[model samples]
Target: MKTISKWLALVVTVFLVLAGCSGGGDSADSGKGENGKVQISFINGFTGGDGAYMKKITDAFNASQDKYEVVELQEKDHYTKFKSGEYDLVVIHGNNLETYKQDGLIQDMSSVLEKAGIAETDFHQAGIDTVKLDDTMYAVPLDIHPLTMFYNKEFVQEAPKTYEDLVKINDELQAQSKDLYALGVPSSGLVEFYMLMIAAQNGIDLEKDGYLNFAQPEYAEALMQFHDMVWKDKVSPAGLGLDGEFQTFMKEAQEGKAYQTAVALTGPWFYGGAKEKYGDNLGVAPIPQIGSQLAAYGNSHTIALPANVKDEEKLAGIAEYLKFMYTPENLINWADGGQAPVHLPTLEKVTAEQEKYQIAYQNSQQFDDYVSAPQVYQFGEQIRYMNESVFSKVVTTEKLTTDALMKELEKATEMAKQIAATAPQQ
Candidate 1:
């Protein structure tokens, strides 16, 4: 919520349009403008509220320096545009680095960050590993958005840290009124939530299991913990279709009207809107630990050097921008944008002054078990298989039985294998 008005908030609507819709590049140009100040064009999928945060970051850099100007664009197809050689720097998801590297769309970033005075070790190891392939780095890690629980403060007096707490909170709310329920399983990040349970409760290792490792009974049992919440436990309603949890969480409760969906397990992106709607009533916490660990499933944003940019001037600008952006003071505002700063130095700053960034910037304890995507080129595809092919079907169709889920997993596994075979060798 702090980032809602941290810097340059006014006139953001106009900035939003220009940042998200504009396109840039010159085929014969060396990315250096006539003034001799290099122009570094950046592209990313940080559209909507996200676009404002990133735009502010780049805008600040542009104002602070005269030697370079950073222009950022928010494109739905950012990676594709980067591949077209129109952008020098682009932000991609941690899960996508492998695909980007394999396709030769980005160059090794092992030296770019180091040369900019940012140490690779300062980032979360899991985040660092996401950009590394064959011991070579391809991107500089930005922020981590871990799956967390957002609850209505009025409905639940305290955050649920354990499975028992969840049950008690659920019963207490339902006791007041049947319509008031404390838990609402997510639809968009269903795969991450499911994997978080298995890792915490069952201790399933991702590296050992591989990317498409959802066919086992243990995995099925873990997934059912959520499906049962909707079907058997009755904590959540059936057919909470795509992003229904978030939609309901942000739904403004009328005067004297209690929220139907009071609790949500979603990523940090929910903070900007939820805080606006619920204010201090919006509480955030690590996703409750059903077992021994509070390991949360997380995703990250990484700034990568697009391979198409060969201009030395633009590369210099990109390097300076990386250094300026991650400077602890400059990067702190990013957390106000509802992300956990994975850069260790910036992490220290956020935790040292919790209330300063307390709203949605997750505290340090959450990252102890925070993880990036599995080291597989098909990681993104595996999530698609689970979310669209398997998990979503369970929610929409109410096929909660283990045998039924396993059958769907088998089909998904075949898909996983087919895609792996078709992909070029690493």
Candidate 2:
């Protein structure tokens, strides 16, 4: 009898110990909050005013749900951190989606969309198309920021309706020696984007058979037009980089100077800052017809799940969080942060609201027509090199002709192709 009793006691002790170990292991592996709510982190580069709005949305999601907790991390290099497993999801520029998808750093989100009950058609067609590579969805687009025209209402009663009008305004401004120009052209690599916009307007395809074709006549014409604006017409201040142009415009506007930039070609993100400085004097309009058709440069912000996150529960949590973030109500909050909503329903709501900057919102609606620059990996660096080595010379030095700029562009294209070839393949 004593032996049996002792065996039973040992068995009970061993079972209890095993159960406790299993419980601890589950808790450690799950990384759940109290009550088994799955914990996930979202990484993004919303360090400006948008960060506050993102935080509010995140907090609202946390409060509305008990099954998941989303923690937001604001970091500029979100992709690096996401690859390190620090975040379950990351918001990347729409341009980077292709690079990330090709490298297998981010996973196809079709399953996530299905699980979240989101159809591809739910978002703006342009935004949806931006994140799709051959029918495989990789990211959910959040917003589109298109380069639009910001004109000084005090200087110009109506926005320029045509390219000739823009040039005439600049010519008039220069005649007055008013220290004001019709436009502030940024020489800091933005000239490449401007050229792309103009090329798109002329129906010139920038990419052909996986190669860049900037040696085309349309590109040459675009280059000359930009050069003339800076050097010959002197509409743009000589040697004015992006920051220099922005600072000059903002300073003049803030000081109520008679001679301020008459029109600025910038993105919707600048609307908030410009409105703050110029108040009602700031006007927003679609980029005037620069080419045969109206086209401008634009890009989007997107949310994507990292490829390293293989845990189903964590992925489910992420999908839920994204769905919550894109709800019509939450998207309105996103718009309040100066982002143009990408969800179709939210866009409809925003259009109806009309309480915010109506001109900016209306201009944003035209993003579908905007042309986005090619998003090849390291392509931005190649463009920057072209700007500094080739385009800058044309604007600053009278000796460098448009033909010379075209030759440099050809070299840049070759270098870009080499870089893209070496970049990670899909």
Candidate 3:
């Protein structure tokens, strides 16, 4: 009886030990908020070369402090991981923020910022406005990525002040030689092409009355003119889609086959690539304007906290790291992506490297022509749909009809309205 009891005790003890091991207590908790170490996952959709620039900033931030650590998760997969409640903070583009906010994946940082004593004015007005909805701030913007025309100083020496001037130059270039197209428009660059053109041509305010009103006649006219420039005038490449449009133009520019692109609708990374590939031949200008309004299509990369992160000290630490990221000292490093800084005060005090990126940014006559906020979300898509139809027909040399295109625009706007209705608003 004693031996049997001893064997049963041994079995029970072994079972308990196995259960403890399976419970994962010994394994390190990736998110253990203990011992003054706060782990934050920084998420972004930046899978491009720009990711390298942001990584540089994040790495420095992590090393700068023992209290907080920022681990950047690259691409859409980052969000997938973040959604599993594995992250504390988010640093993503504005496009995905609204949905994230609605899904309760991200927390409202307004109260958090207030408690932390960070003034809203400490950041750029545009940046602040970009992340706020219905008087509640959700994300904090890092930079305003707007469209600028990067031109070749060799062929187009004089900056065209008006759309007429730009069109006239295109006419001259096209009339001279077929191989030397005056401008190239990306086929897949539907959203960017429409927004920049609308901003330059009519100065459409993307945000109005909590919804997008893109069916206005002025917007339609801009779309028609853009279509005319590409298809009717043969200025842009034919049979091109979004993927090939920029590459075709860049290749042509490098080979001296083209003079200038219709406009290079890209973020700051383009400037660095141009400097490396085509040195001194590049010039940047804010998208040109045809009217009194001079708004450009811009988007923001923002910072936010996950809905479940409840630590006050961790939130404070994250804000401090963000303050560091936005400061002039760190912004210069952030500018390695070749984008202009969001903080206007630091715009003038840049390093030599930043100046190289700023040359084109500073020359833009309509640098203030930026429309990078929540309103752009729906209207941007509608404009892209309209532009793609008109531009594609133009590129293929199809007959330009106002009626057919108008129908498409109406459908797109209606679709956008449906989407907006279902869209998460917070």
Candidate 1 TM-score, true structure as reference: 0.86
Ranking by TM-score: 2, 1, 3
Per-residue alpha-carbon lDDT of model 1 for 160-229, expressed as tens digits? 8887787788788778776666666656555555654455556665443334566777767777777777
* True-structure RMSD, every candidate: 11.0, 8.5, 6.0
385 in model 1: Cα distance from truth in Å? 2.8
Model 3, which residues run further than 4 Å from truth?
A: 1-30, 33-36, 114-117, 205-213, 243-245, 253-267, 290-292, 351-354, 359-367, 373-397, 424-426
* Tens digit per residue, CA lDDT, model 2, 93-193: 87777778777888888898788878888887778778887688888888877767778887788989777888888888767665778887776635655
Checking candidate 1 for backbone clashes, the offending pairs are none
Identify the candidate with maximal lDDT.
Answer: 2
TM-score winner between candidates 1 and 3: 1
Q: Residue 72 lDDT in model 2?
A: 84
Question: Candidate 2: deviation at residue 408, Å?
Answer: 0.8
**How badly does each model clash, as a count of residue pairs?**
0, 0, 5
Give candidate 2's error at residue 353 in angstroms: 2.3
Worst 10 residues of 3 by lDDT: 24-33
In candidate 3 the C-alpha lDDT for residue 4 amounts to 100
Question: Which regions of candidate 1 deviate over 4 angstroms?
Answer: 1-29, 187-201, 206-211, 251-259, 396-399
State, as a TM-score between 0 and 1, how close model 3 is to the true structure. Answer: 0.80
